[model samples]
Target: MTVADAAPMPAGPGEPGFAEAVHVFNSLAVPEPAAATTARTVEQVRSAIHHAARRGLAVRVHSTGHGAAAARPVRGALLIRTALDGAVEIDPRARVARVPAGTRWESVVRAAEPHGLTAAHGSSGTVGVVGYALAGGLSPYGRMVGLAANTVRAVDLVTADGRHRRVDAESDPELFWALRGGGGGFGVVTAIEFDLFPATTVITGAAYWPGALADRLLAAWLDWARDAPVIATTSVRVMNLPDFPDVPRELAGRTTFAVDGVVHADDPVSARRCADDLLGPLRAIGAPLLDSWQPDRPSAVLLAHMDPADPLPILGDHLLLDDLDAGGAARFLDVLGEGSGSPLVGAGLRQLGGAYATPSAPGGALDRLAAAYSYAGSGLAADPDAAAALRAHCATVRTALAPWDTGRVVPSFVEDFEQPQGHLDAERAAAVERVRAGVDPDGLFRQDASPTTTRQEKVP
Candidate 1:
């Protein structure tokens, strides 16, 4: 169909429904697009793209807006919020799922759990499936399953030319590769299909202890993380929680140390053994203030990280790092641990190794992470002053950990648009840019390209 044939117009700023069309999860970094619309169907998405092309407007796309903070600014651009209409369709026999663009991780887990299967979903259920998977998802099961993007089998998107295309390994291998972790900007993804893994139950949850023992606990956790079994993936964090209604009384208004993750195995006995091997030593150091680790359905993995559900102001930073020695660990604690007076609500390192370090066969432009850990720290940005404090603390943490920093990032873990981010090397970035040029020669979606993917200067 011709671009002129697609008839739809988006709402401009201050127009009716514009606010809803541009809703975002991170209140701190709300976008102000020149025009915006929510697309509930592939036809609607095509219409929006055609409208933007006709108007000479650059295009930006988002689903749930969970990554709004990291997304390039949408000023003077047409923003298409994909709320594609569909349910999560699962093929139990094939262990695959066809997830619509706006669908969240919870729905996939709910749909697949009945069949004893689950996608490599992130810690929070609210995170949109397409964005997370396409941006190199670091899941609770990352050590076992690898980057979630590697599991993608197909993608359905509306290119800048207003043509709806389904690209996959068999049909368009290069486009498929670029779509999976190649850093976006190819088109507006309408839906995605990816492989799922068999999992009935998993040992997952968090354990918190008084921050006074953070040093010893961190030491023990690091010792255990080295050569940890592939079946387990975990993270250690130092949290300074506010006294909110949802926060547990014991945890509220305190600086606490925590360790949480998932242990998946073929049998319950093996899962328990792995969980014990991880939690036993930490627990022995001192009595935990609270411990919720136990065997549960795969769905429980989503809640283990305790990510807030409601929209809120947030500012943060992230890094991929080499293995930490005692000095590195001490530096981490000095900035984010007890008595650091850090304004960040939470800061920590996610263990990375096992399958995460191994490149997938037929993987995308961005596949494996060579680092040993993923470090992230974030705080609530309630106002200009609070935001400044958070940014300052983020810089402090960054400086403290610079020695071990790999100077790379997992796109999904990146928290700020200004954060240094480069998941692909020069060769891969050049190749991704070539694919983008082929699909969007007019640069209609140029602003949608990640800073690391396109040669064009990004909008600050």
Candidate 2:
């Protein structure tokens, strides 16, 4: 039966339902659409699309709204906030998982761990699964398993015509390719099925030292990261944490350098050795103020990064960078480290190599990031003046590191819509466009495309 046959209408602006439907994780980028609705099933998603088509409204899709800041404005559109109803289905023997849209990584981790398996999930367990995986996710296990998008075996989405299609490498290779990391705009994804890797326990956590030791720590970390093992994925950050009850006393209101990541292997002994190889040199530089690195179940990996649980106004910038030499390292610390007087709460580089540099056998549009490290800096925007200051600092940092910038980005890491974001070359982008045009001929989902990947005018 078609949605046109029978379905509830969406809520217009100012309606109670509209308020609930437009909820987002980033307070700074709350969407104001012409109409909105929550879709808990495929039938509801089809109905929302049919409604938008009849009203001549463009369609936009989001789940947790964690990437709301990076998305194009939803003005004059009907936003479909997906909350697909279902439990994560795991196939232990096949080492695969089928996750419904609106589901979070925490649930998947819990489900997979029992079977001695885990998916390539990001640091924050609260991030929606569909958006992260589809946008070429950079996981705690990324260096070992490659981008999360490569693990996708199939996708189920409701396209513009209200047709329910399940595309995979065999059924429709082209669409499947574009859907993986072609910068979205395909349709409302209902569920995703991806391969899971065998993992039970892993050594993961964070270690911190005073900012005074940043120079030595930074140099030592870069040297180690250049030849770091594939079994370990780690990052170093300079943080200025707030004084909160949950925060450790030593870290609050102080500039500190931190190193955190995951180390996995077939046995506990090997995992410990991998952790020692990376942490030993830094420990020699100075005593740490706080250290939480330890062997634990895979679920502990999420807490190691320390992403906030509540929503906040965030402003930031991202870049995929080539190897940074001594000069580049000095430039980075000059703008964001110790005495830089930087407004950003956190700024650092994520180690990217190993599997990240290798292409997947049957990968999607964005299968791998060729860069050496991912740089990101962000600050809280508590008010208008603070927001402007954060923007200026982000630009300052961008300019300082321009020499090493690869002029590319991973869609998942992009924090703002206005940042220079591009993951695909011209040839690949054009190819993705062709598929988009075929699937959405009338541009119903055009606004949903990432500005960097499409020829569309930049959103002002």
Candidate 3:
């Protein structure tokens, strides 16, 4: 029977009964799941997809819903909550982590800390391990390690066919490459095994400068970051802070400049030297609000970005540029730094070179792009304009940096696109189509009652 002709299925807990549905996270688009089912194991996850596909329902996966934009959840869909399945295993001998779909980066850090190991994950340890890795994850050691997807050893996924399969370089190579940067559209990734590093302490943290130095400081940051050593990674942030006693006294309710720093190496000594080179020029710009660049445990990974500990809906977007020279720096500061652009909670640019480009394996998604990745984000708010402003600012930065543009958009931050094509490759897009076809050939996975289009009809 056609998806349109298929009958409605039963709903699961917290979901509206088998009718029009919407996906909800802290913010962004909320679409419905394929159907309703409680899943805790790979078999169960597989069964749920089978049943939902039969009933003309769609399925979407969630891991803490960290990077989700308003557009993620599809209506009449099955929501797969990976966090509830929670399992994390670290293999010291192999320096690899066998983690479940629901696991968070923070869990991996804690598990590896006692063993003197660390995963080359992003600044937010609160993010889902699978979701982050799928996005060609950038790292503090990014210049040295490449994107997080580069370190992936294997993946356990429930494909479009309702079959549970393990994919690596040698097995299902095309699907494997798509998964690293293309994201969950291809299938429900239930578990992932990837490489980890040996380290107990890292020299990490950020420093805040007032907006007065926006011009000079940012120019200097761009220069230093380009030549940043393999051990270190940095980004610059410009925003106005709200006055909260909990917020650092110097930064509360004021225009500010921040240079986020990271040093993921064996000891604090080497880490510090790398961090100092990135920060030296900033000292000449403005008085710093906080300079907590010192040796700290891996568990304190959150300090690197100072991303909110509290869960709030977020809208994020990124760009990969060839360089952020003086003119490019001015445009960024003008659009997002001092007062030219709308209110944005956070905005920064990271230098991407070193190990990030030369992974032990080819960088599946990120390698397709040029070099130099820039990131921008904002807290969740009801106003769609906030999302628009964040996107507009990124566009300005992209245009200004077009001279050095390599044309790559990581999936994690590319959700808001009307049609997400530029951010992904044909093979990756084909993989998502294949997974959708194999798993939900009847078209139930689109969430819309219609389910007739190749691109699932999104429930607004």
Candidate 4:
């Protein structure tokens, strides 16, 4: 339902609701971020948060809320929007950026581009930078630079206890690690300072093929991508395109395979050579109807996947794999091929390992997420059951690949679950608890659905 349909709530400066909340976007019928919070400024944020805590209100912090859960707070909750509207500082000399909690990945990229630098941003620029890095951002540049969270220089946030704290590799090593991939279960981050790359652009884009070649194309892609260069960030997607005019005529109304490409920190000649060398096998497998894998501005890297710019309710399920060999390729086709059950709009296989699997610095928290290869589903219709079924299918795929499955899941793509934030398993759970106890003594930030201490039994 639209905000107009919901009952209006009294609000203050930062507390915009109904009318104001109408501008907030949720891919589903969920309330907008404006309706979720009643505060704007840092001081106002603190007051509203403390008031809610004293009154026993559940505090939820959101920016875009891309992976919002099935259940959400309605009363006595404070949603901070300050960071979303401000707090972006770029230091070219220091090669760092300090962004507010609400900053989107796209803005960070644009800001850094002028400085000949780039933040390791996700494919979907609409995602919040703080949220993404907090959950250990796995960006297109991830394979080359490692997870985004590992680049963090410092994090300024308020803990559950209503106290503000700055955490970094040096200040609070343990807490810093847990916050990296543990989600926001520890506290509400207001601002974050992280490293930036000296990259203005790259050779990036995508190539699409007809779905009938799903098996052939995937098999070829698997072989070619297995040993791809670290400079080339690639993904193979199985997409069920709608009959939208905006979609390429060849791909419209068809299930197509895309060999998405992104090349960074490489010369033009090396970049083109890398793309040709890596993708040549896929091209040889079948004639692509649409091939746009040419040089382009780095800022347009999102073109690799060509996802929609608007927000739409989405359900995603993911798992890490050890390999996607020829035999595994056949199985993947059978599960998500032309006419599979609960047909997904999009499916992606991202190669992992390389820089992704490298050991993190001495005390990095995100070093724990296991596995390099990750498979994810995107664009589920607004049907809950349909979404659930898609998730089930992904789980089945994971189980079938048990020997190759890493069991480690990225928080970014685990949104298909009833409670998306609860996917952090046993090992990640213990480390997260120590992070909370050490950094957020009062538990002011709402990182996950439930704090680490309360959900001890679920993991152990």
Which is the winner by lDDT between candidate 2 and candidate 3?
2
lDDT of 1 by residue, 58-154 (tens): 9999988888999888899999999887899999999999989999999999999999999999999999999999999998998988999999999
* Number of colliding residue pairs in each model: 0, 0, 30, 21
lDDT of 1 at 357: 89
lDDT per residue (tens digit) for residues 271-317 in model 3: 76776777776786666877877778877766678877665555655
Instruction: Go through the candidates in order and give each one's C-alpha lDDT.
Output: 0.89, 0.91, 0.65, 0.68
Better of 1 and 3 by TM-score: 1
Question: Clashing residue pairs in candidate 2, if any?
Answer: none
Candidate 2 residue lDDT tens string, 61-133: 9999999999988999999999888999999999999989999999999999999999999999999999999
What is the C-alpha RMSD, rounded to one decimal, of candidate 1? 2.6
> Quick one: best lDDT, which candidate?
2
Model 1 stretches astray by more than 4 angstroms? 1-8, 453-460
- The 10-residue segment of model 3 with minimum total lDDT is 448-457
- Candidate 3 Cα lDDT to native: 0.65
> Any runs in candidate 3 off by more than 4 Å, and if so which?
1-25, 33-38, 70-73, 84-86, 267-269, 363-369, 384-405, 419-421, 425-460
List TM-scores for all candidates, in order.
Answer: 0.96, 0.97, 0.84, 0.87
